[model samples]
Target: MPAEEGSGIHCRLDELLADRGMTLTELSRRVGVSLVNLSVLKNDRAKAIRFSTLTAVCEVLGCEVGDLLTVARRP
Candidate 1:
């Protein structure tokens, strides 16, 4: 599914992983999150994320929260 209409937050998981030559499966394993949950976040289908989950992902990706998510402008 596409991102929620009017929802401004954009997840940068796809770009970050791609830039680091990492796959979602590898990230999921490293971050201790299930592939399906990671996929939901990666696809921008997740409405919210737990802080622990966010921290884990950021740690594994070597990024800050701002690098993982952004405020997207609505067109």
Candidate 2:
């Protein structure tokens, strides 16, 4: 489903990964998630993510959930 009409869902995963000089493949390797699966999340194509997966990604990337995603009023 599309993001809610006014939820303003957005993602910063790619930007943060770039800032850390980490590539998708690298993140996949470290986080034990498939590159294809990570791509889904990175590209905002994923409908949902397991809490364990999210936690593992955060641990590997040294980031919080808030750093990877954001919700704001849709302009």
Candidate 3:
């Protein structure tokens, strides 16, 4: 069955960064987030995202949230 909205959704922050040839270090520097905190987002372990952090990421990467995330299948 298909996943429900926000149920099995996944973030693609790491993938988008990679596709753009950006390192997590560079993104952390640009986004004003610590490497460790950003790693949580990058590794898809973040329970939620702050609006400020989301804005920072959008600013740095020039992408809307939709461009960096997708709904994933549930197990």
Off by over 4 Å in 2: 1-8
**Poorly placed runs, candidate 1 (over 4 Å):** 1-3
Judging by TM-score, tell me the better candidate of 1 and 2. Answer: 1
* Candidates arranged by lDDT, highest first: 1, 2, 3
Clashes of 2: 0
Task: Find the 10 residues in a row with the least total lDDT in model 2.
Answer: 1-10
lDDT of 2 by residue, 19-70 (tens): 9999999989988999999887776667778999989998988889999877
Best-fitting candidate, measured by TM-score? 1
- Model 3, span 1-75: residue lDDT tens: 114434455778888898889999999998899999988776666677899998899889989988876767666
**Clash totals, every prediction:** 0, 0, 0
Q: How does candidate 3 score on lDDT? A: 0.80
lDDT of each candidate versus the true structure:
0.89, 0.80, 0.80
